[model samples]
Target: MSNLSSIYIHVPFCTKICSYCDFCKVLYDEKWLRKYLTSLEKEINLRYKSNKIKTIYIGGGTPSCFDNAFFEQLLKIVATFNKGKDIEYTIEFNPEDINENKIKLLKKYGVNRISIGIQTFNKTLLAILNRNSDYEDIKKKIKLLKDNNINNINIDLMYAISNQCLSDLKDDLEKIISLDIRHISTYSLILEKGTVLYNKKMPLISEETDAKMYNTIVNFLKTHGFCHYEISNFAKKGYESKHNLTYWNNNEYYGFGPGASGYINNVRYTNTRNLNKYFNGNYFFDKEILTKKDVMNYEIILGLRKIKGINVKDFYAKYKVNIFDEYNIEPLIKDKSLIFEKDNIYINPDKLYIMNEILIKLI
Candidate 1:
């Protein structure tokens, strides 16, 4: 059974590009946006299977960077799809881009979730990353969102920059927890090829420091009543991102835009990152149809990213192979890196920082 109930649309236009970001993005321009949205409509109408989409995540190049009229145009294009009763339409915003009018516009369009990209409250760090929003601006933007009744929000936090320390992260976390936000996603900075930071030869925080920071974040969030549902995500009660769960659970979804990756009919495909090529109607250039063994490997890797790990029974039912018999998980269990409890097998909380190492050992 193919569960293609989620849609991911990429708007590759940003008001300003962050030094650390490597996503397929360009500076904001009206002519390009109008053309991109038109192409987006064409791409969605061509690729989407017309399933009643339960979640539509409009990710950036800063989806909130436009004027109200242009925002309405983007909304109208997505409005072509059939939305479920409780649709989770989320948009990523930079605090500087958010205003009283755009906040209300999002509400009117049935957007229930907002993910703000406030990478850090540290002004010095913001300047280093080429970001404009400051801590005070973030506070005002958040208050504006709440006043307009759009409270299902997620705050993105970043760490492991060139000069960050454990105490700096502690300070950042304390300030973040005080914001009354529903969800928080923390990512260690990855200096990828082609990114300005990577090009500048910026050094990464030491492995020991990075691991310590990860542990601190998890323990701190747990104490504050946030469930560490996914490795990098924490949420209050039922606020886990429904759209992301579709991917973590290894289900099929529609990915429509330049640089979007999607799995459908057991084939994984990545759209071409070249915007000019995309605008000229070359949306996808790379795809792989999975074999049964490939699917099994993917399931093991993706499912394990969740805090609950994998359900042993679900594995047996889905692939008709005993998980223990198919692989040597018992070795990992013996090493205390993996834990099996309540019919679920998960990475040990203490070993989550080295989860990739454990997964490599398992698969």
Candidate 2:
């Protein structure tokens, strides 16, 4: 309702759940899919005020896993949006789920970006994560997407798995770089409470090793003509993910479907993770009506996730108060944990691994 320019739709159905995933998802069921699609449309109709959106990210438990019928229907529903001419429409895909038909359907619906969940190229690691994707198979899939003209692709690389070494990480990076994609999103494994890995008590690699891997990714990507645009994202020049930038920039966006979150009209809200609750017209689980101070806090926390950090002048203009006067960041800057250069403030690149501690000092 506040001139929102982005919308995120969550599809919570997967053919198989990964061992380390804790996202809201369930095994694919036709009846549930029908119901979910219906409920999603109703939620949008009830909540969305018909703003002309600039980006639509269809993220999921493998959004590309659906058959053409359901996928087309989903697209039709999304087509209701008043989209911009240059809108960035993205959908998440698993390598095994992508095919000619699905890629064609995506193109027909104006989806220009595809985010693939290829955690790693190591067969042993893939098995450990209960995911199935080999380099050869993924190469074929990427070729398929390109054959159809959807070239803005992002592949996810996950590191710090149990028993994963620096060599394994380097191998993964080499294969991913060879894929010639536009953007890459990297994630370090975190043991969530309800995931299969957590149930098995899977241990993560050492923190020191994890930090080394993070630095390796940053350095490797930067050396390969990829811009390290965010803490965990690398992109080719002019190919950054605008939908994700919406979150990092603390801009308002609509989040539809289960387990999604949105910010609008100074209120941050999350939809219920429970599908039954969502289907029963009980979409909202919780809402936080942010005060002016809370908004500023969010602006700092989210904006700093970008590698370039926040513009001090823009911050002052938005809040009508100087950030240096509000938070005593001088100590951090003095210690070199935070860097202030060219009217922008950011966490030191080397200390990005400990960004939380730096944030705690400021917030």
- Most TM-score-accurate candidate: 2
| Residue pairs in clash, model 2 | none
Q: Using lDDT as the measure, which candidate wins? A: 2
Model 1, range 256-348, lDDT digits (tens) per residue?
888988889999999998988999999997999999888888988999999999999999888898889877899899999999999999989
- What TM-score fits each model? 0.97, 0.99
Q: What is the lDDT, from 0 to 100, of the residue 237 in candidate 2?
A: 99
Model 2, residue 246: what's the lDDT? 92
In model 2, state the lDDT of residue 19. Answer: 95
Global lDDT scores for all candidate models? 0.88, 0.93
Write down the RMSD of all candidates, one decimal each.
1.2, 0.9
Q: For candidate 1, what is the TM-score? A: 0.97
Model 2 whole-model lDDT (C-alpha atoms): 0.93
Q: Give candidate 2's root-mean-square deviation (CA, Å).
A: 0.9
* Model 2 lDDT per residue over 109-195, tens place: 899999999999999999999988889989999998898888999999999999999999999999999999999999999999989
User: Cα deviation in Å at residue 251, candidate 1?
Assistant: 0.9
